[model samples]
Target: MRALLLSLLLGAAVLPALAAAPTDPPTPPVPSTTDGLIAQPWYRPHHLIGQVAGGQGMVTVGVGYTTLRGRLDVDVLTGYVPRKYSITPMGIFTGKATYSPWTLGLGASRWQVRPLSVGGLVNYTASRGMNASLDGKYPKGYYWWPARSRAGAFVGGRVAYELPTKANGQPRTASLYYELGTNDLYLVSLYSNIKALSVADILTLGIGVKVDL
Candidate 1:
Protein backbone atom coordinates (compact mmCIF):
# COMPACT_ATOMS: atom_id res chain seq x y z
CA MET A 1 0.00 0.00 0.00
CA ARG A 2 2.83 2.42 0.91
CA ALA A 3 4.63 1.70 -2.39
CA LEU A 4 1.44 2.43 -4.38
CA LEU A 5 0.94 5.67 -2.44
CA LEU A 6 4.52 6.73 -3.19
CA SER A 7 3.99 5.97 -6.89
CA LEU A 8 0.92 8.15 -6.93
CA LEU A 9 2.85 11.03 -5.30
CA LEU A 10 5.63 10.72 -7.92
CA GLY A 11 3.03 10.72 -10.74
CA ALA A 12 1.50 13.91 -9.35
CA ALA A 13 4.93 15.61 -9.26
CA VAL A 14 5.64 14.67 -12.91
CA LEU A 15 2.17 15.76 -14.10
CA PRO A 16 2.81 19.49 -13.60
CA ALA A 17 6.11 19.38 -15.56
CA LEU A 18 4.52 17.56 -18.47
CA ALA A 19 1.62 20.01 -18.54
CA ALA A 20 4.13 22.90 -18.86
CA ALA A 21 6.09 21.13 -21.60
CA PRO A 22 5.77 22.76 -25.02
CA THR A 23 3.47 20.90 -27.37
CA ASP A 24 3.11 22.80 -30.67
CA PRO A 25 6.10 24.62 -32.15
CA PRO A 26 6.79 28.05 -30.72
CA THR A 27 4.69 30.82 -32.24
CA PRO A 28 6.52 32.97 -34.76
CA PRO A 29 7.59 36.19 -33.16
CA VAL A 30 5.75 39.30 -34.31
CA PRO A 31 7.84 42.25 -35.43
CA SER A 32 7.40 44.96 -32.87
CA THR A 33 7.75 47.80 -35.38
CA THR A 34 8.40 48.65 -39.02
CA ASP A 35 12.10 49.31 -38.43
CA GLY A 36 12.58 45.66 -37.57
CA LEU A 37 11.25 44.60 -40.99
CA ILE A 38 14.45 45.51 -42.86
CA ALA A 39 16.96 45.63 -40.05
CA GLN A 40 19.07 42.86 -41.52
CA PRO A 41 19.58 44.44 -44.92
CA TRP A 42 18.63 48.01 -44.35
CA TYR A 43 20.11 49.29 -47.60
CA ARG A 44 18.42 46.79 -49.91
CA PRO A 45 15.96 48.22 -52.42
CA HIS A 46 12.27 47.79 -51.77
CA HIS A 47 10.83 47.62 -55.27
CA LEU A 48 11.05 47.40 -59.06
CA ILE A 49 9.06 49.64 -61.36
CA GLY A 50 7.95 50.14 -64.96
CA GLN A 51 6.65 53.48 -66.12
CA VAL A 52 5.61 55.59 -69.09
CA ALA A 53 5.99 59.27 -69.99
CA GLY A 54 7.02 61.40 -66.92
CA GLY A 55 9.19 63.48 -69.35
CA GLN A 56 12.00 60.91 -69.50
CA GLY A 57 11.18 58.57 -72.32
CA MET A 58 8.40 56.60 -73.94
CA VAL A 59 9.01 53.62 -71.66
CA THR A 60 10.89 53.38 -68.36
CA VAL A 61 12.01 50.58 -66.06
CA GLY A 62 13.81 50.92 -62.76
CA VAL A 63 14.55 49.91 -59.22
CA GLY A 64 13.54 51.84 -56.13
CA TYR A 65 13.98 52.21 -52.41
CA THR A 66 11.27 53.14 -49.96
CA THR A 67 11.51 54.49 -46.43
CA LEU A 68 9.20 55.86 -43.73
CA ARG A 69 6.79 52.95 -44.13
CA GLY A 70 6.62 53.44 -47.89
CA ARG A 71 6.07 57.19 -47.67
CA LEU A 72 9.37 58.39 -49.17
CA ASP A 73 10.43 56.78 -52.43
CA VAL A 74 13.49 57.27 -54.62
CA ASP A 75 13.72 55.63 -58.02
CA VAL A 76 16.38 55.36 -60.70
CA LEU A 77 14.93 54.61 -64.08
CA THR A 78 16.31 53.93 -67.51
CA GLY A 79 14.11 54.82 -70.44
CA TYR A 80 14.31 54.09 -74.12
CA VAL A 81 12.95 55.57 -77.32
CA PRO A 82 13.14 53.92 -80.75
CA ARG A 83 15.15 55.41 -83.54
CA LYS A 84 12.05 55.42 -85.74
CA TYR A 85 10.20 57.45 -83.13
CA SER A 86 12.78 60.15 -82.57
CA ILE A 87 16.09 61.50 -83.89
CA THR A 88 17.83 58.34 -82.62
CA PRO A 89 17.41 55.42 -80.28
CA MET A 90 17.78 57.48 -77.13
CA GLY A 91 18.59 56.16 -73.67
CA ILE A 92 17.43 58.36 -70.81
CA PHE A 93 18.44 57.97 -67.19
CA THR A 94 16.19 59.59 -64.63
CA GLY A 95 16.25 59.92 -60.88
CA LYS A 96 13.03 60.71 -59.08
CA ALA A 97 12.36 61.55 -55.43
CA THR A 98 8.80 61.45 -54.17
CA TYR A 99 7.11 62.31 -50.89
CA SER A 100 3.86 60.57 -49.96
CA PRO A 101 2.88 62.00 -46.62
CA TRP A 102 -0.36 60.11 -46.34
CA THR A 103 -1.94 56.72 -47.10
CA LEU A 104 -5.60 55.92 -46.71
CA GLY A 105 -6.60 52.37 -45.93
CA LEU A 106 -9.56 50.83 -47.73
CA GLY A 107 -11.58 49.10 -45.04
CA ALA A 108 -10.32 45.56 -44.31
CA SER A 109 -9.70 44.74 -47.92
CA ARG A 110 -5.89 44.97 -47.78
CA TRP A 111 -5.94 47.92 -50.14
CA GLN A 112 -4.56 51.43 -49.69
CA VAL A 113 -4.54 54.66 -51.64
CA ARG A 114 -2.19 57.56 -51.65
CA PRO A 115 -4.26 60.60 -52.50
CA LEU A 116 -1.40 63.02 -53.04
CA SER A 117 2.27 62.66 -53.80
CA VAL A 118 4.67 65.45 -54.70
CA GLY A 119 8.03 64.95 -56.31
CA GLY A 120 10.87 66.20 -58.47
CA LEU A 121 13.05 64.54 -61.03
CA VAL A 122 16.14 65.03 -63.18
CA ASN A 123 16.82 63.24 -66.43
CA TYR A 124 19.81 62.78 -68.73
CA THR A 125 19.22 61.57 -72.26
CA ALA A 126 22.04 59.99 -74.21
CA SER A 127 22.38 59.89 -77.97
CA ARG A 128 24.87 60.67 -80.68
CA GLY A 129 25.16 64.46 -81.23
CA MET A 130 22.76 65.08 -78.35
CA ASN A 131 24.67 67.03 -75.76
CA ALA A 132 23.91 69.36 -72.85
CA SER A 133 26.42 72.00 -73.82
CA LEU A 134 26.09 75.42 -75.27
CA ASP A 135 29.91 74.99 -75.28
CA GLY A 136 30.34 78.09 -77.48
CA LYS A 137 28.33 76.25 -80.16
CA TYR A 138 25.47 78.71 -79.73
CA PRO A 139 27.30 81.49 -77.84
CA LYS A 140 27.23 81.78 -73.99
CA GLY A 141 23.91 81.71 -72.02
CA TYR A 142 21.84 81.35 -75.18
CA TYR A 143 19.94 78.38 -73.72
CA TRP A 144 18.84 78.42 -70.11
CA TRP A 145 18.12 74.66 -69.98
CA PRO A 146 20.54 71.94 -70.98
CA ALA A 147 19.70 69.94 -74.08
CA ARG A 148 20.59 66.59 -72.47
CA SER A 149 19.43 67.21 -68.93
CA ARG A 150 15.95 68.17 -67.80
CA ALA A 151 14.49 69.10 -64.40
CA GLY A 152 10.84 68.57 -63.65
CA ALA A 153 8.22 68.45 -60.92
CA PHE A 154 5.09 66.34 -60.50
CA VAL A 155 2.01 65.62 -58.39
CA GLY A 156 0.38 62.21 -58.41
CA GLY A 157 -1.70 59.54 -56.70
CA ARG A 158 -1.56 55.77 -56.32
CA VAL A 159 -3.70 52.78 -55.44
CA ALA A 160 -2.04 49.70 -53.97
CA TYR A 161 -3.02 46.19 -52.91
CA GLU A 162 -1.02 44.39 -50.25
CA LEU A 163 -0.06 40.74 -50.61
CA PRO A 164 0.76 38.11 -48.08
CA THR A 165 4.44 37.89 -47.12
CA LYS A 166 5.65 34.97 -45.07
CA ALA A 167 9.39 34.71 -45.74
CA ASN A 168 9.97 38.29 -44.69
CA GLY A 169 7.60 39.99 -42.35
CA GLN A 170 7.57 43.08 -44.52
CA PRO A 171 4.39 43.86 -46.44
CA ARG A 172 4.41 43.12 -50.17
CA THR A 173 2.40 45.49 -52.32
CA ALA A 174 1.58 46.08 -55.98
CA SER A 175 0.51 49.55 -57.01
CA LEU A 176 -0.66 51.53 -60.02
CA TYR A 177 0.12 55.23 -60.16
CA TYR A 178 -0.46 58.35 -62.23
CA GLU A 179 1.26 61.70 -62.28
CA LEU A 180 0.80 65.09 -63.93
CA GLY A 181 4.05 66.97 -64.31
CA THR A 182 5.79 69.82 -66.09
CA ASN A 183 9.40 70.46 -66.88
CA ASP A 184 11.40 73.47 -65.75
CA LEU A 185 11.40 74.78 -69.30
CA TYR A 186 7.65 74.39 -69.48
CA LEU A 187 7.17 76.15 -66.16
CA VAL A 188 9.45 78.97 -67.24
CA SER A 189 7.52 79.36 -70.47
CA LEU A 190 4.23 79.37 -68.61
CA TYR A 191 5.38 82.07 -66.19
CA SER A 192 6.62 84.29 -69.01
CA ASN A 193 3.68 83.67 -71.37
CA ILE A 194 0.74 83.11 -69.04
CA LYS A 195 -2.11 83.65 -71.54
CA ALA A 196 -0.51 81.73 -74.38
CA LEU A 197 0.02 78.44 -72.53
CA SER A 198 -2.63 76.91 -70.33
CA VAL A 199 -1.83 74.42 -67.52
CA ALA A 200 -2.84 71.47 -69.70
CA ASP A 201 -0.51 72.58 -72.46
CA ILE A 202 2.46 72.48 -70.09
CA LEU A 203 1.48 69.27 -68.28
CA THR A 204 2.89 65.82 -68.98
CA LEU A 205 1.28 62.61 -67.78
CA GLY A 206 3.05 59.59 -66.33
CA ILE A 207 1.57 56.19 -65.61
CA GLY A 208 3.26 53.19 -64.01
CA VAL A 209 3.13 50.05 -61.89
CA LYS A 210 5.34 49.28 -58.89
CA VAL A 211 5.90 46.04 -57.01
CA ASP A 212 7.18 46.12 -53.45
CA LEU A 213 9.59 43.40 -52.47
Candidate 2:
Protein backbone atom coordinates (compact mmCIF):
# COMPACT_ATOMS: atom_id res chain seq x y z
CA MET A 1 0.00 0.00 0.00
CA ARG A 2 2.90 2.49 0.78
CA ALA A 3 4.55 1.65 -2.57
CA LEU A 4 1.22 2.31 -4.28
CA LEU A 5 0.95 5.74 -2.55
CA LEU A 6 4.56 6.66 -3.43
CA SER A 7 3.96 5.80 -7.09
CA LEU A 8 0.84 8.00 -7.27
CA LEU A 9 2.68 11.00 -5.69
CA LEU A 10 5.58 10.68 -8.10
CA GLY A 11 3.18 10.61 -11.07
CA ALA A 12 1.47 13.75 -9.89
CA ALA A 13 4.80 15.69 -9.63
CA VAL A 14 5.94 14.47 -13.04
CA LEU A 15 2.63 15.48 -14.64
CA PRO A 16 3.03 19.08 -13.35
CA ALA A 17 6.64 19.30 -14.62
CA LEU A 18 5.62 18.20 -18.11
CA ALA A 19 2.80 20.75 -18.11
CA ALA A 20 5.23 23.56 -17.13
CA ALA A 21 7.83 22.82 -19.87
CA PRO A 22 7.94 25.82 -22.23
CA THR A 23 6.55 25.51 -25.75
CA ASP A 24 7.61 27.77 -28.69
CA PRO A 25 5.68 31.01 -28.37
CA PRO A 26 3.06 30.74 -31.13
CA THR A 27 5.20 32.32 -33.88
CA PRO A 28 4.02 35.86 -34.12
CA PRO A 29 2.95 36.19 -37.76
CA VAL A 30 4.35 39.24 -39.62
CA PRO A 31 2.12 42.28 -39.46
CA SER A 32 0.04 42.81 -42.61
CA THR A 33 -1.31 46.35 -42.17
CA THR A 34 -1.02 49.74 -43.84
CA ASP A 35 0.14 51.34 -40.60
CA GLY A 36 2.94 48.84 -40.34
CA LEU A 37 4.27 49.73 -43.82
CA ILE A 38 4.07 53.47 -43.15
CA ALA A 39 5.79 53.12 -39.81
CA GLN A 40 9.13 53.10 -41.64
CA PRO A 41 10.89 56.37 -42.62
CA TRP A 42 9.73 57.56 -46.03
CA TYR A 43 9.65 60.55 -48.40
CA ARG A 44 7.43 63.58 -47.76
CA PRO A 45 6.80 66.88 -49.62
CA HIS A 46 7.48 70.39 -48.26
CA HIS A 47 7.04 74.02 -49.38
CA LEU A 48 7.55 77.71 -48.40
CA ILE A 49 6.69 81.35 -49.41
CA GLY A 50 7.13 84.95 -48.18
CA GLN A 51 6.80 88.67 -48.95
CA VAL A 52 9.34 90.85 -50.73
CA ALA A 53 10.70 93.95 -49.06
CA GLY A 54 9.41 97.49 -49.82
CA GLY A 55 5.81 96.28 -50.18
CA GLN A 56 6.61 94.22 -53.23
CA GLY A 57 5.65 90.57 -52.96
CA MET A 58 7.15 87.23 -53.94
CA VAL A 59 6.01 83.66 -53.71
CA THR A 60 7.66 80.27 -54.00
CA VAL A 61 6.22 76.77 -54.15
CA GLY A 62 8.10 73.53 -54.27
CA VAL A 63 8.31 69.85 -53.47
CA GLY A 64 11.15 67.90 -51.96
CA TYR A 65 11.97 64.47 -50.62
CA THR A 66 14.69 62.59 -48.80
CA THR A 67 16.17 59.23 -49.83
CA LEU A 68 19.47 57.47 -49.58
CA ARG A 69 20.41 59.78 -46.73
CA GLY A 70 20.42 62.76 -49.13
CA ARG A 71 17.93 65.55 -49.86
CA LEU A 72 16.37 66.48 -53.22
CA ASP A 73 14.59 69.79 -53.73
CA VAL A 74 12.75 71.55 -56.58
CA ASP A 75 11.02 74.95 -56.60
CA VAL A 76 9.41 77.63 -58.76
CA LEU A 77 8.98 81.33 -57.97
CA THR A 78 7.24 84.52 -59.15
CA GLY A 79 7.74 88.14 -58.11
CA TYR A 80 5.63 91.25 -58.65
CA VAL A 81 5.71 94.97 -57.85
CA PRO A 82 2.31 96.23 -56.71
CA ARG A 83 0.45 99.43 -57.72
CA LYS A 84 3.47 101.00 -59.45
CA TYR A 85 2.83 99.34 -62.87
CA SER A 86 0.03 98.12 -65.08
CA ILE A 87 -0.55 96.28 -68.43
CA THR A 88 3.02 95.14 -69.06
CA PRO A 89 3.80 93.13 -65.94
CA MET A 90 7.33 92.39 -64.82
CA GLY A 91 7.94 88.93 -63.45
CA ILE A 92 10.21 85.91 -63.44
CA PHE A 93 9.69 82.14 -63.44
CA THR A 94 12.41 79.99 -62.01
CA GLY A 95 12.75 76.21 -61.69
CA LYS A 96 15.57 74.56 -59.86
CA ALA A 97 16.46 71.02 -58.78
CA THR A 98 19.09 70.34 -56.21
CA TYR A 99 20.97 67.34 -54.89
CA SER A 100 23.29 67.45 -51.96
CA PRO A 101 26.42 69.50 -52.75
CA TRP A 102 25.24 70.38 -56.30
CA THR A 103 22.31 72.28 -57.81
CA LEU A 104 21.00 73.31 -61.24
CA GLY A 105 18.53 76.09 -62.04
CA LEU A 106 16.67 77.42 -65.10
CA GLY A 107 14.93 80.79 -65.20
CA ALA A 108 12.96 83.14 -67.46
CA SER A 109 12.19 86.79 -66.77
CA ARG A 110 10.06 89.55 -68.32
CA TRP A 111 11.44 92.90 -67.15
CA GLN A 112 8.73 95.09 -68.78
CA VAL A 113 10.56 94.10 -71.92
CA ARG A 114 9.18 91.55 -74.37
CA PRO A 115 12.40 89.63 -74.17
CA LEU A 116 11.92 85.97 -73.25
CA SER A 117 14.98 85.66 -71.14
CA VAL A 118 16.40 82.22 -70.50
CA GLY A 119 19.20 81.33 -68.13
CA GLY A 120 20.92 78.49 -66.29
CA LEU A 121 22.64 78.37 -62.95
CA VAL A 122 25.11 76.22 -61.06
CA ASN A 123 25.34 76.45 -57.30
CA TYR A 124 26.56 74.88 -54.10
CA THR A 125 24.78 74.72 -50.74
CA ALA A 126 27.01 75.22 -47.74
CA SER A 127 24.36 74.39 -45.15
CA ARG A 128 20.60 74.28 -44.69
CA GLY A 129 19.08 77.30 -46.50
CA MET A 130 22.48 78.76 -47.43
CA ASN A 131 23.86 78.71 -50.95
CA ALA A 132 25.80 80.61 -53.61
CA SER A 133 25.08 80.40 -57.35
CA LEU A 134 26.55 81.62 -60.62
CA ASP A 135 23.86 82.27 -63.22
CA GLY A 136 23.36 83.70 -66.69
CA LYS A 137 20.40 85.29 -68.55
CA TYR A 138 19.90 86.17 -72.21
CA PRO A 139 17.14 88.50 -73.29
CA LYS A 140 15.37 88.05 -76.66
CA GLY A 141 13.06 91.09 -76.86
CA TYR A 142 13.19 94.87 -76.47
CA TYR A 143 13.91 96.53 -73.11
CA TRP A 144 10.72 98.63 -73.57
CA TRP A 145 10.99 100.25 -70.10
CA PRO A 146 13.49 102.48 -71.91
CA ALA A 147 11.51 102.37 -75.19
CA ARG A 148 14.10 100.05 -76.72
CA SER A 149 14.65 96.35 -77.06
CA ARG A 150 17.83 95.50 -75.19
CA ALA A 151 19.23 92.23 -76.47
CA GLY A 152 22.11 90.95 -74.39
CA ALA A 153 23.50 88.36 -72.05
CA PHE A 154 24.11 88.75 -68.33
CA VAL A 155 26.25 86.82 -65.85
CA GLY A 156 25.75 87.06 -62.11
CA GLY A 157 25.86 85.32 -58.77
CA ARG A 158 23.71 85.20 -55.63
CA VAL A 159 24.03 84.26 -51.96
CA ALA A 160 21.07 83.17 -49.86
CA TYR A 161 20.57 82.33 -46.18
CA GLU A 162 17.52 81.20 -44.24
CA LEU A 163 16.44 80.69 -40.65
CA PRO A 164 13.78 78.40 -39.21
CA THR A 165 11.64 78.54 -36.09
CA LYS A 166 8.58 76.94 -34.57
CA ALA A 167 5.64 78.29 -32.62
CA ASN A 168 2.37 76.67 -31.55
CA GLY A 169 3.74 73.45 -32.96
CA GLN A 170 4.14 74.95 -36.42
CA PRO A 171 7.20 75.48 -38.56
CA ARG A 172 8.18 78.98 -39.69
CA THR A 173 11.17 79.77 -41.85
CA ALA A 174 12.63 83.04 -43.13
CA SER A 175 15.21 83.82 -45.76
CA LEU A 176 17.37 86.69 -47.06
CA TYR A 177 19.34 86.70 -50.25
CA TYR A 178 21.31 89.03 -52.53
CA GLU A 179 22.29 88.81 -56.17
CA LEU A 180 24.73 90.67 -58.44
CA GLY A 181 24.76 90.50 -62.26
CA THR A 182 26.26 92.48 -65.15
CA ASN A 183 25.45 92.58 -68.85
CA ASP A 184 25.16 95.01 -71.78
CA LEU A 185 21.76 96.08 -73.16
CA TYR A 186 21.77 96.52 -76.92
CA LEU A 187 19.58 99.52 -77.82
CA VAL A 188 17.25 98.91 -80.73
CA SER A 189 18.00 100.89 -83.95
CA LEU A 190 21.12 102.29 -82.28
CA TYR A 191 23.84 99.63 -82.36
CA SER A 192 26.46 102.05 -81.02
CA ASN A 193 24.32 103.40 -78.16
CA ILE A 194 24.54 100.46 -75.76
CA LYS A 195 23.68 100.59 -72.04
CA ALA A 196 24.39 98.23 -69.17
CA LEU A 197 21.29 97.08 -67.31
CA SER A 198 23.38 96.30 -64.22
CA VAL A 199 21.89 92.89 -63.45
CA ALA A 200 24.67 92.41 -60.92
CA ASP A 201 23.15 94.01 -57.81
CA ILE A 202 19.77 93.14 -56.34
CA LEU A 203 18.62 92.10 -52.89
CA THR A 204 15.64 89.92 -51.90
CA LEU A 205 14.44 89.31 -48.35
CA GLY A 206 11.48 87.16 -47.36
CA ILE A 207 9.77 85.18 -44.56
CA GLY A 208 7.51 82.14 -44.80
CA VAL A 209 5.92 79.15 -43.09
CA LYS A 210 5.26 75.44 -43.67
CA VAL A 211 2.14 73.27 -43.35
CA ASP A 212 1.56 69.52 -43.59
CA LEU A 213 -0.98 67.94 -45.89
Number of the predicted model whose TM-score against the real structure is largest: 1
Off by over 4 Å in 2: 1-44, 51-70, 83-87, 98-213
* Most accurate candidate by lDDT: 1
lDDT of candidate 1 over 1-213, digit per residue (tens): 999999999999998888877675678877533542454576677889999988878999998888776688999999998888767689999999988889899998999999999999999888885655766778778876788888999999999998887375777889999889999888989999988889999999999999987
What is the lDDT, from 0 to 100, of the residue 104 in candidate 1? 94
Candidate 2 lDDT, tens digit per residue, 1-213? 999999999999898777866754667545432121222335544445332421122443333332222223343444453334533443433343333332222234111111121222222112222121322232543232321111122222222222342332222223222222212322232345335332223222233332322
| lDDT over C-alpha atoms for residue 172 of model 2 | 23
- Relative to the true structure, how large is the alpha-carbon lDDT of every model? 0.86, 0.32
